[model samples]
Target: MAAETAAPAESARTWLVGLVRRTAFAVRAALSRRDGRATAVTVAAAYLVAYHLGLGHLGLRAGAVVSRPRFDLVVVEDPVALATRRVAPFQYEPVALLSAGPVEYLFAPVNAVVGLALAGLVGVTLAVSVVAWRGPAACRIGAGAGAAAGLPGILSGVACCGPAFLAVIGVQASAGLLAAFRWFLPASVAGLLLTLLWVGSQVDPAAAR
Candidate 1:
């Protein structure tokens, strides 16, 4: 009876291992292709375009004057005020459809450029590490680490407020967390560099030299 149970468990483990190996092989094959770099850049550009046009808006503020028997007050509300009040880098509230204007057109390109830069850096790092190690194992390790490092930055871009992953995971997204959001880009870059270094170290020292 114990042998029967062990047989099924061992078979399950073997199946799982095969599935992982096949997935890794596919990913490595895709990344090793000549057009892989171009594909990465195009994907990065698409993400930026989505972020700019789909997620961003331009807003204007308008004020109303109220007169009382004894006093007068002017109440104001607008995009500027909302932006100021929100501690998050991006606004959590939905932008009105009509609010987007020339301002969005002007700023969207800038944001896209920044996004492209970040994505390009990641792609280059992955490519270089793969080349340095010259193996599917290196490609798999580098790609996994690179993706992990970029998660925070990607969440920062996608979230209406601060880092979306933290919020989704039930973290409060405190002031410190919001501030740390800005560091994600640099952190990803650093992580990629470390991945490359680690992969290089794993290689034959004579070959690495």
Candidate 2:
């Protein structure tokens, strides 16, 4: 019985290793090409756009309703509803509102600039990782790191003034939630820089071959 179990475990381990190796090779090859990098950037930008437009929620407004404390700010998709107002007594009322229209219209140029910046960051990270690892492992590492770094901005954009990052999971908008961008803006930039440095270190020859 022990021998049989051991044999199956060994087979599974070997299979997993082979699968990882193949994936790594494929990822490395893709990132090595200019077209692949462009495609990746395009896909990332599309995801960002979709997320900003609230498509990330798949058109669902409110998911599961649960009781929670009120927030300090509320984000709305319409420019007309961007003003502050009172809610109820004892409950925290929203003192500010973040309108998606202003985010998209008034700061339209800023959006372009941020998008370009993210694309460049991802491209550079992928390029460097490909050089250092020379396999799918590099692509995986680069992609993971990029996603982690970009998460703050994505959450901020999606949440803005709703219910924190809860909207990403289909949660309904809540009152008094703070604007995510107000805090995440600087955090995203810091995360991006930290991720770049960390990824660069991962490829260091002195650390590993």
Candidate 3:
């Protein structure tokens, strides 16, 4: 009797899982049919993201990075004094979408909704990377790794708002562009994303400043 009562709830959950799986596979198939170097570029991007995440896991942060004086040296710079100084080192500011900007503004309620969007995007990006990379084994591995990494971040809503969506767009564009050009598109796509993220992180605006 208890088993019967529990059956419908389990069935509904299973159905939802099946739907998500189908959607993911369909999107992957669509992206896979696009280009020659698409797979390679996406795989590379996934590797890069993974490496960055690992470094972060190791606690690499600008606040912690010791600064060396370019021309002269100061024994210490007071946080209070620096706050008043013009052009304090970048990390001094808070970043919503990496120190805050359009994404933070657009992703308002940036606390929860952005969290869901980011988690979904990270999962989508991993799925995209696998499809682009080709070969059954590699794709499976990438997908598995992405799910593992993304699920936790998604569940915790931590690190979800990083440059992830932009990376996905970069990967998608790389596929189409590379299909048209040669290896050129891959580098072009990558350079463009790296530049945007770097500038966005370092530059300013629109957080709660």
Candidate 4:
């Protein structure tokens, strides 16, 4: 029994390793061009901006009038400790407040890092999907794959709002449902990774050449 189990486990491990290798190769091939890099950077920036806007960290303050153009930064005391404070699921409290004209931005170091990381993943996935779809005729992938890659970002945006967004949609936020919000960030990351892996697997390395 032990020998049989070990054989299967070893086989699974080997398969997973092979899949990762292939995916890495495909990703490299996808980002090898100027267009691919441009696509990734643009998508990532857009996603980051959208993500922050959804969280209300970066937005125009309502009913705010600017008499004079000015920029201000207010940092909280013990900012390093406050930066780790979680205000909501996957949402951290801001350690600093930035004001410029009618716009206000909450600057949380951890949140910015997390948002950038997620944006990068989303950007790379879409970039890879584009290459697979349009690069070589031989590199065949699902028509919906690229579109599907955007789903995680949408989900994460909703997750950022937590119960407030759900309430607006007329769904009651139950205890269990509220708990699920905590997993949205990690789940979205997982979704992006899985989608990227699937997209990579579909692209033939030779075809990418």
lDDT score for residue 196 of model 1: 41
lDDT of 2 by residue, 1-209 (tens): 99999999999897655554543443355566775566556656764554334422222223322343222335446433332222211112222333332132222223434545654544444444443343435444444443443333333343222343465567664454444334554565565455544554333232232
Q: Which TM-score value belongs to model 1?
A: 0.39
RMSD in Å for model 2: 16.1
Residue range with the least summed lDDT across 10 consecutive positions in model 1:
64-73
lDDT of 2: 0.43
Q: What local lDDT score does residue 109 receive in model 1, on the 0 to 100 scale?
A: 32
Better of 2 and 3 by TM-score: 2
* Off by more than 4 A, model 3: 1-4, 35-209
Order of candidate numbers by TM-score, starting with the best: 4, 1, 2, 3
Candidate 2: which pairs clash?
Answer: 24-136, 71-176, 71-177, 72-176, 73-176, 75-161
Overall lDDT per candidate, in order of appearance: 0.45, 0.43, 0.34, 0.75
- Candidate with the greatest TM-score versus the true structure: 4
Residue pair clashes in candidate 3: 39-132, 95-99, 95-100, 96-100
lDDT of 1 by residue, 6-100 (tens): 99999989765555454344344446666555555565565555445433333232332223122222223464443234334533333223322
**Candidate with the greatest lDDT versus the true structure:** 4
Which candidate, 2 or 4, would have the higher TM-score against the true structure? 4
Model 3 vs. true fold: TM:
0.23
| Candidate 4's TM-score | 0.80
All candidates: TM-score = 0.39, 0.38, 0.23, 0.80
Ranking of all candidate structures by their lDDT, best first: 4, 1, 2, 3
